[model samples]
Target: MTETKEWFESWFDSPYHGMLYQRRDEHEASAFIDKLFAWLQPAAASSVLDIACGDGRHAAYMKNYVHEVIGIDLSEQRIQKAQKLAKENLAFYKQDMRNVFRLNYFDYAFNFFTSFGYFQHYRDNVIAADSFAKSLKPGGRLMIDYMNVDRVKDQLVAEEVVEVEGICFNIHRKSENGKIIKTIQFKDASGKPYSFEEVVSEFRLPDFKELFERCGLQLITTFGDYELNPFNVEVSPRLIMIFEKH
Candidate 1:
């Protein structure tokens, strides 16, 4: 867990990281984000903070809906690309989500694309939650998009491979306790492999309810997908949680 940051930094700097998103199905991702924002429906005057905002795709898309959008990620390369592509209403910053940077400033905070999990230490996660809480104004909204752990566990595949933009990736998953341990290995055109492992903490409905309560947030809504559909153990591919500061 302690090595997670090193792993991410290395992985992000590798050629595979840039190529990975370039090859992703943009149509699907765009649809997914569109539905997500529709559900969020941020006020036009609201300021948004996007944590781990990879490449700022969501921030760029969100610019039309919000007054200002700030996207932060730990990867400098990703932030650089994001800065290059961002609109006037959107800005990208390189920062660790766990550390406190400034005061209460945002009306809404978003952690999308399963970006909440990764820290080796539970305290790190809590620190991040605290930072998020402190960053938001009173009654600010928080939207978290994470993997549907139960669904993923039940449908777990030992190994899978996908190819996009001339790059290939092999993904593997193993479940232990309430966590899914994932390894993504990327292969370039020459077949060289670069890999990273991520441990995702699994939380059930009650678990999230408790976690949010402990973090001084109230769960406003839960959806199985970006479409705002009711969530159940069997159907949804994602666990979208909407919370409000207490």
Candidate 2:
């Protein structure tokens, strides 16, 4: 597929994507990883892969626990920004998730903060899941942090305006075609208008189970939040799934 065909391809590589989500930087990543490591107790000698590791914040934090850490993202700009931190036992690469990387190499794989479900096609989603499975060793583990679909649909704000660095981002959201669609419109300092849309599939647990099982990943456990609370269909804010490769 061509890069231009996907919404994430353009927006994720753009400066606005970073600006709007600047608050989700290392501080948040560190907090989550701290909790994750404490609970999971991953081996210190394990190899880790951070999929869709925007700017390598999570991978950088995770390097403290693992032997080797590799971060990958489709965005060239993000990979370039992340590459500065590459060193012994840590590295960054530009890669598309639909394409497998370092087959059967990593002991652990992570897809954090709703990184999946960006593809518009079900086949593509399956391909991405297969890629994840292919990238891991037979007994490797994978963690995916996602939003609780029911909770998100219940609590979604229809519209909002966010001002960041002198730009007013007018946002609209709605669920249609089995996906949550968000539209962001803003103007630059020079009054240049720009618009972007984020579309993600509102996949529920069964959807994920089927998607992963087809790709050789078995669900292990699930959490509802960063603190690792039990999941609630109506109340939980996050759907964090842990899987193991067969």
Candidate 3:
């Protein structure tokens, strides 16, 4: 496969990518969603939007709370998988976050599980923030769950190897040029090889605050983890932010 500079297009769509991350704790994700639902207190008529919703897992889970949920992602494979689970109250779309999905359409928007910060250019991040702002109704809320760059840097693991379903996966991770990059190499039972890399920007609270301010969004609060504890730059595993449209 000819890989492009935009690595997510190839990496996220691969079956191996899904297999590697299949062990994510659904119970923990649901608990966080439940807590966020209580905090947002969305009404029955309110609509929810899930950005970069891989396989629509959280978006499907969110339908139990909101009247309607719409999930969007750049990967067609994930969207096709998500489509199987769609219901009257839940829907999925193949779309990019940097593009506007709908103007003033949703009351609540979520970018969960470190979905943001994938683009190579800083302006793409700004454009995504603006798109999120444009897609929300006035005073609408947005929740973004992202990795804490500082914590990730402090706990950096340079390399690791794992075997999944009889396939060997060699993983390498590093932080460079204000981004964290992970490269994965593996082979199938037939000895066919595959390789992919994931790159995420090292954005902090201040960076997000500036982006939000410029995009007509207000930074409401920041949390440290799925537990919704206060954010600490030095020790927090995640930087979960809640923002509102201004």
Task: State model 2's lDDT.
Answer: 0.92
lDDT of 1 by residue, 87-195 (tens): 6768899999987555678889989878876666567677888888888888998888888887888889999987878666788999876567878988667777777
lDDT of 1 at 212: 67
Runs in model 1 lying further than 4 Å from the true structure: 1-6, 21-23, 164-168, 186-193
* True lDDT of residue 193, candidate 3: 90
TM-score per prediction, in order, is: 0.88, 0.97, 0.97
Cα displacement (Å) at residue 229, model 2 = 0.5
Q: How close is candidate 1 to the true structure, as a TM-score?
A: 0.88
Model 1, C-alpha of 162: deviation from truth (Å): 3.1
Ranking by lDDT: 3, 2, 1
Q: Taking the tens digit of each residue's C-alpha lDDT, what string does model 2 give over 1-246? A: 655669998999989998898875566668888998887788999999999998987788899998999999999999999998888999999999999889999999999999999999889999999999999999999999999999999989999999999889999999999999999999999999999999999999999999999899999999999888888888999999999999
* Candidate 3 Cα errors over 4 Å, as ranges: 1-5
Considering only N, C-alpha and C atoms within 3 Å, which residue pairs clash in candidate 2? none
Model 3: residue 93 alpha-carbon error in angstroms: 0.7
Q: List the residue pairs that clash in candidate 1.
A: none
Instruction: Find the 10 residues in a row with the least total lDDT in model 2.
Output: 21-30
